[model samples]
Target: MPAEKPSHFGASARRLVGRLAPYRMYIAISVALTIGGVVLSTLGPKILGRATDYVFAGLIGRNLPAGATVEEVVAGLRAQGKDTFADLVAGTPYLVPGQGIDFDALARVIMQVLALYLVAALLMWISVRLVNRISMWTVRDLRSDAEDQVHRLPLSYFDKQPRGEVLSRVTNDLDNVQQVLQQTFGQLLSAAVTVVAILAMMLWISPVLTIIAVLTIPVSVLVTVLIASRSQKLFKAQWAHTGTLNGQVEEAFTGHELVRVFGRREQVTARMREVNEELFDVTWRAQFISGVIMPAMFFIGNLGYVLVAVVGGLRVATGTLSLGSVQAFIQYSRQFTQPVTQVASMANQLQSGVASAERVFELLDEEPQVPDPVDTPPVSASRGRVEFEDVTFSYGPEPLIEDLSLVAEPGQTVAIVGPTGAGKTTLVNLIMRFYELDAGRITLDGRDITSMTRHDLRERIGMVLQDAWTFEGSIRDNIAYGRPGATDAEVHAAAQAAYVDRFVQHLPGGYDTVLDDEGSTVSVGEKQLITIARAFISQPSLLILDEATSSVDTRTELLVQEAMARLRTDRTSFVIAHRLSTIRDADLILVMEQGRIVEQGTHTGLLAAGGAYARLHAAQFRGAAVQVDAEKQAGEVPGAPG
Candidate 1:
């Protein structure tokens, strides 16, 4: 299947952020702490420069030659009537003029710098903690919402898309969203805050140097935008190919036996290789294009750094800027460019995350199945009287069933026999309300089925399909699935009635034997019997058996037929069978052709009329007809009680 188009990036981003509304307090705190950390970090270079300035001033004020003593410098300052300045210098420990430094004063400045760094580190830790909490909480809610959405969607939706494609959205796409939130979101926020703080400090130091550094912004942005524009589409393609690849692997592995039986292993492998090659092609292009962003931004940043150094040095040499200020400006220029580069890299990651979010939101936004009416009544006392009047339905543009009508009264078995695509299963689906009719209505127990809640209506009916399904649990659990609260004795009795106990008793654990997924641990016939036992435990007022005994052996089929006779004794039943012998005694036989009932009567009545049903019967039981003829010639009757 082709990939679905992604949703608008702006809309997906807004919806993703809106998911953080519940944790807005944490988000606010994280923002504040990030600002505080960036501010403190930005002040470090200037404070260190101030300390350097103090040492410079001490040397110049003393007028010290290379090896002059602190006493001589003090004497010189006192002679100039600078007593306060002289005393302030004398108070410094280890204040030898040119031979030694002011160790005491320098230690105090170092301690202040260390204090700022410590506080900044603490703030960063707290901010990251908060962001992580918020991101994890939001992703958890997204996973839960996606899973619940799957259940609410109509069956038709699953019929249209591969199961693995939906699974990829729920698991793989959500994982991408989580990775971006945890890593990229925090980095992006810190980068933005750092950029603003660094630029402000740079301007304060020297507007000339600030302009030199600011010139790089537009160039870097243009490069990043150009590269990202091309990369975004590749990123979208990468994820789409990923979904397709996952679907291929799932399909191949699930049907491995079929592939081997049909000698199509080479074909399956070739198909998988084709999908894998497509995935590799898109993945490398996305990586290569987005990969250009970092290096391009770095080149622009280096250009700005060289310009700042040259301009600031000239101003310092001309006596317009102090050495300490020049030093601080250099540090600020580097800080300013670092965030720009970080932001550029983060932009690529953010685009990929947005692509994943688009897939997830597509599923979340699918229209759910139409709900029952608000004032719908509860199902009345059900006597299993089902009526379909002038019903019509279609799975596509062309209608499959038109003006179809049927009635199954209480305690009657309606056997539906037809060729393939005769709308037999479609009719059952309409009766159970699995698919809504295009027009007309179906009634159960004299009440319009549409007027009653679907849950209430389906609860009173039990279905056993041709392909039986069992979950990964003990055999006992599979049998008791329809009624979870069924007693162990009830489970055993139902199993015995369906003849499942015949094989189950021979297993090592008896009823407690575990079945793997798909119930492949047991034979197909055994699986069908287990489903029959499940329906028996439900004790439904209405029953549907669609080729329920087709997989069983002759002896087992006879046992199941006896059980069916007892099961339909006092309840309404709809039986769809290809074999004409199974439903010979049905109270009403419906022969369908091209989605319409061409004949309706007892089996003998239909055969005597020689209509569609009679032709089907002859086609299926040609040998039986010849045997009846031979028995009649031998003076023996066929179909007589032994």
Candidate 2:
């Protein structure tokens, strides 16, 4: 069984950061841009405040006369050590005693404000772009790694988990992480920088006012911390519920027919509804708490701002604080509170991303089963001979095969036949090393099968199973799947031998006809033929046919059997057949029952002995002509052979 995922959200965050290690340049650029934007925004407010102070000092403190010329106003401020025209207006009074200040300097202030916005906008854009690009690249790598892991993982790993849940980890979890990357990273960085710069500027202008504004900091941090701590666990629960819900949906879709046949749709639906409701509840509570962070911070922020203004106003009226400094303090207060609010808003997104990252990393941390041996030598040459010596096997607690001994010499056809519950299929699985043997060893030619690299062992084997799987592709594509570099002529020939060429020729696009998912557009028999064509195209040194022709109609089965015969000529073969007649001409027939070889002999020998093989043969054919006759009879019927 696979390992369980960790519940900690911080683990996911650390994992996400690790993935970003490859893109240091992008991350650094993004941080730089974010800080630049925050700095510019913080400076804008201070510049406006300074300009207000200059205007007040020039008009009211200096008492400029009515209709004072711009030169006179500047001269008065210059005598007071505010020499620049820009500075004179910045400290001018709003209400002049005799004359109003000129609109020219106000226009300059507006231009400066406009310049600040333009620069800040560019910085914000760069920051957003960098964050988005970095995140997308990270997501791409993560998704690719997940997909590669799926292929490299042992097939047995899939047996214990639902397909939907596995998909949810890659799809839904990754998507959530991507959202976090794109949104939260930028916002959090910018907010932190903005808050720091604004607070510094506020304190620089007036430490007393800065302290007053910061009174809400502890309260806001306490609320955010509490909300964030609870939100992380809820977010983890949300992700888990999502996986469970997806699992249920997947199970329903895959077993639609079964549910209908068994009249259990209501049972399945009720169960799924329960899971779905739980998912909704989990997400709702999590989002609700996370959602409160922003508004709660905003409220505290407004309250803090009001307090700062009330206290600063009294100090200004008492002639202890300058109006310009008080005005600057208000802007700084907004800056400090705004980022804390932003941080609160971003907390859930970051936590959720961390949760997903943890899950993805856990999958990456899984150790692959059947690890390649260190310094293992490659096989010089692979002979088709295969042997099972005192082989014993079990899946979990039940023994599927025990004390099994068998061998197929090079260029020999060994048929395995038995009842439905017999271990014939398990024997083939043992040979393939899909499951390790609990006792004894299996050898290929002179080498233990286990000693050979799985890649090397599998490369020499061709398989055609009872249910042949095909991806959505053209007829030619399916045939060439096993041998990716095979030529068109080789593919056509393999298709012709498997009888798939006959069907392909009738399609509108011939060999180029596109297939639907699971190749459902094709007949079951035709799909089986395609699988055979794929196996034939590979030209493997050894072949295993597990009820290979069981799905094909009589005529197609004959063509397939003929193809199998030709393919088996120079290769060792293991034929696991449900129908006894199919293996009568095999060089050796081993009858398996309850994980043991009950009988072994020629067709006549088994028939004469009236052993397990004879009984199985009787059950399948009732002593009728064994080979093609049963197949011929099956064609006249509508369903698969018993």
Candidate 3:
């Protein structure tokens, strides 16, 4: 298979950010709270540094001579050739030389720092809660949009896509996005603000020291960029493999019965293992590569920290900076490195979110089906007069149906019979407008189908397909699926008409028994009867039975045919017949071959004319012909069981 489309990092990131537009007010509040909290928190170290200075000055002041001037203290230290110590002492807020530390002043600064931090913590806590709320609401809307998008997509989109992969993209990928936004959004914003605020504080104290603290930033960025580039591709591949693995597992389970009958259990298992291993490999690589970012950032940050400490201490001793300022600068250096480290770590997680975002955006960006016309031309009253005028259609390059024209008059039972792949089902599909005609028009009661809304067109038709699909529901609910607002009495009547009442009476709950999603509790024939009842209750103007009676036993088939015959009395009907005998009594028998109708007439008349219909009839009844002849000699009924 071709490689999954590579996600453009910048573009996907922009789109991800765009999802926050509707929640901008909440996001703004969160951001304001985060900035305020970060600002106050960054101020704590500077204020605490003043407390350090006061304590240090008090310890030394008591040892000095009493009533000493600031210059006297410096001069005395210089006289003893203690120039650096003198400079540090001179730089301090000079207390009277004999006085002890100012306990009251230190206490005041400490309380201020505590108050700032407590308020900062409160703000941050509240912001985090708000951010989480916004994240949930955003994801909820995103999931809703994805669900709506799936419905609007054309049927051809599903024909090419796997059900499981699409489900994974909508479900699994979306969950990943939600997690990333919830966990990372608030923290990232706080870290970013902390970095900026701390950096500014550092610069305010000493630009030289700030430069030294930030020297290793270029290396940290390089590490993140290099690892993230490789990790992104791996992350994308990991998600793609996850979707593929899910598809493989779903396929295996749905087809498990066939696989067991064909003895291909080992084959299916091997295929699953292959996809699982691929998923495992890509996930491991993605995690391992992204994991390298944090350690690399920490090493770079530690190097910057050491350089800042050495320079800061020297500046204090040289009297270019106050003791408190150096202490505060050292705190700022540590604070700065922390935010940088956090940001680097979150970069990897952001890449994962971006990959998932790409998947969702791909879904959202799918071309929807051509929109229904706003100004729908009103259709005539339902007479079920459907006509295809030189209809041409193709699934791919080659036309599947070319110049096909047919007319089903009101209340006529049209039976379409053909070999496999002869476009037997395609004819009905066209009438239902599943695929657009390539070069023709289909009309209902003289109005072009395109002129009317597809909903209105399909409302007049009811179909009973070969597969009797039933969802998890009561039998009554399953029958009522054809017409949701149908009364219980109508459901029962239709059930009785289709002979469903016969078997349902034996079921424990009758119409109310809950079936599994696959309807596996009921036998195949019973499921068919329920579906026929469903279509029967719909009371449509047009009916389509696509091999609708193929699953039942002969006796049940006859019963269903009888019921269908009654239902078909006053409606235009299209029956795609495989067992030639069932449609022998239809009003018109159409034989299709290679996208063209080769023959058309009544069953008896066509058989007598000896054309394609005769050949099909002969092929089906040759055994019966032989049996009858043998029975004539043996003096027994031909079809009687021995």
Candidate 4:
């Protein structure tokens, strides 16, 4: 049974963050630099306050007692405004216009400001470097793990879902997580620490003023919290719709031939337009709602600043504060808002990041239907004997192959001929352990294939699938795919056996010619030959050919058939075909329909039996190549070159 899927994303996140704990030293360094950067920033305002106090002292030519308060200065000025204290403020002489300025004190303040700026810049540089390194490394680890999971997943998982949809999760969805890890995660960490530090500093400076300044904190925080919670769902929906849009585009492009043949181009385009519109609406709403965070923080923050100014100014007028202290308090008021706004904005980004993280985690959480067992025994080669005993299989809810039993001896060719959807391919999949049988045993050399590791079992079998894919590489490389370390001589020998050597020798680059995507530059028949050559190079104990000659010309088919004869001399072979003519010479033929074998015998025996095999053979191969040619000329099916 598969493991239960996780319901709470928070647990998954904590798990992911735990993986980062190994980088504690780097994280500490980054945090220290950020704190230094913030502290240096605070110094700028402190220096400005000192400069203000000095300028006032120089104008009056009176030295203030150490630790004097701005409120006392304000009270003295007010007293002078009233009576006996009037001459106190008036007696202070002002500096002559254009006279020498207080260069020494001004220079010291400027130098201190520059020093703070320099320290802030240096700390920021170090912090960014450490943070970015951690982020990039985390992304790399995540993507690699996701890709490994995809390769290990059961084939049935792919059968039930579109290729494009699965691909979008790895590509686009992971990219979203990468953006969060690389760009947003570090900022969130720094913002959080800075906000805490500022709030602590505000409370320390003056609890009364701090309380007044933070009057809007709860309201501002509540609003951002509400918005973030709502945007989480919206962002998740936006990502899902984006994936749907991408899947539609991929499907339309891959199946353009069908779309054009059926004249449904406009219909597909209209559907795509609708999908795009849905995605646009979802994205717009998510982003617009998220956008309100910063501005709301700013509104509350500015209101706090105004409140501080009013209260502090009155305290100074009442002789309770010093000019320098008022300046420092005002500066602190501005400083307090910055980290608050920073954290509020980060809440929005964090919501989006969490949404993407949930999607990525979903893929990680999927349980492969048939996981490779820890105690799986390794398999070695033997006389190629395969047996299926009462095997029953299904994609999921619908059973595709049921109560099937068959055997293939060493050095024999067994052909599976069936109507479409009659479980021919599924049989091969069962032998390869691509899908687990619902009920029954498939064995190789008297050992159950399920008891052996997938890698160990598959290593002994060679397959040339109906839809063979040729990766972008040189012709020689494609042929050598069956055995990675195969020499040039081995590659050439396989190519010669498959008759692909004839085409290779004629090309300008001979064996080095490049095969483009899906081998589109080569003819379909030639690509089939190359695929056969790749299988031949593997030299496995058993060979499975799934419609290997279906797309080739008559001359090409004969050549491949001759090669097939040599390749099958010591190995067991299972051939699947639809055209009937290709498998007439098999040692055994099984006619399958509706997931059951309706008839089984040799060509002459089945012909004498006059069963399902005879009926299909008579109708399909009455005139052999001539009937096929007629169908091709009439455009009923695609034709291969002679």
Pick by TM-score: which candidate is best?
3
lDDT of 1 at 410: 99
Residue 35 lDDT in candidate 3: 96
**Please, what are the lDDT tens digits per residue for candidate 3 over residues 161-227?**
8888999989999999999999898988898899899989998999999889888888888888999
Assess each prediction's global lDDT (C-alpha) against the native: 0.85, 0.80, 0.88, 0.77
Return the TM-score for each candidate structure. 0.88, 0.89, 0.93, 0.89
In candidate 1, which residue ranges exceed 4 Å CA deviation? 1-7, 51-100, 319-324, 623-642
lDDT of 2 by residue, 8-51 (tens): 76556776778888899988888888888888878888778757
Q: After superposition, how far is residue 322 of candidate 4 from its true place, in Å?
A: 2.6
The stretch of ten residues in a row with the least summed lDDT in candidate 2 is: 633-642
Query: How do the candidates rank by TM-score, highest first?
Result: 3, 4, 2, 1
- Arranged by lDDT with the best first, the candidates are 3, 1, 2, 4
Model 3, C-alpha of 477: deviation from truth (Å): 2.5
True-structure RMSD, every candidate: 6.3, 6.1, 4.7, 5.3
lDDT of 1 by residue, 486-604 (tens): 99999999999899999998999999999997898899999999999999999999999998998899888989999999988889999998888999989999988768888899999
Off by over 4 Å in 3: 1-4, 94-96, 101-103, 623-642
- In candidate 4, position 327 carries an lDDT of 75
Residues 233-253 of candidate 4: C-alpha lDDT, one tens digit per residue: 777788778778888999999
Candidates 1 and 3, the one with greater lDDT:
3
Clashing pairs in 1: none
